[model samples]
Target: MKLVAKREGLLMMGFKGFTHFILVTDSQEAMMMLKSEMDWRSNVGNFVEDVRLLIIERTVTDVVFQPRSGNGIAHTLAQFGLMEGTHFFWEDVAPPWL
Candidate 1:
């Protein structure tokens, strides 16, 4: 959410009363975290609580899981991130290799 806020030029105040979020991940555990409540005593409970708060606060609407085979482009991007130690911001056109 912090990365998204930076990308979208949003401040903490901007989250108030905001809606319309779609989260896509390849991890089943991440999907489950979004779908169910987590035990407060668990090691990653704080992170889970934060995500749940976003949902309860109406900042996020949906979460989807994409299989590795179904998300080749994303897989490639992940590799790029690892290789270059950088992140990308797409606007008008993507890199030629992509």
Candidate 2:
């Protein structure tokens, strides 16, 4: 079977007067992953380090996790990612659904 590689990218938006970040997700495991301290022994640790760096640099003053209730526009965006293979970018104006 042929394997298809998935590429994911992060888009940073400028929000005025927002000092903290709250990430909402349905996965408790992901919440734990993000909340854990950076572990220097594993390959995934590098990703943890990146997250730590973001916090250290004050890119996000604070980070928290919230449980998603399968509602809202974010749920729609998540659905889009699942169906469309999660490779897209936009600037200025977003699509009408967003």
TM of each candidate vs. truth:
0.62, 0.54
**C-alpha-based local distance difference test score of model 1:** 0.59
What is residue 66's positional error in candidate 1, in angstroms?
1.6
Worst 10 residues of 1 by lDDT: 1-10
lDDT of 1 by residue, 22-93 (tens): 656677776786677556576566666666665556555677788879988867866676688665655568
lDDT of candidate 2 over 1-98, digit per residue (tens): 00011002212322233335544445565446656764657765555555555444435543444455655655566567668875444556667878
Top-scoring candidate (lDDT):
1
Error of 2 at 87 (Å): 4.0
lDDT of 2 at 36: 72
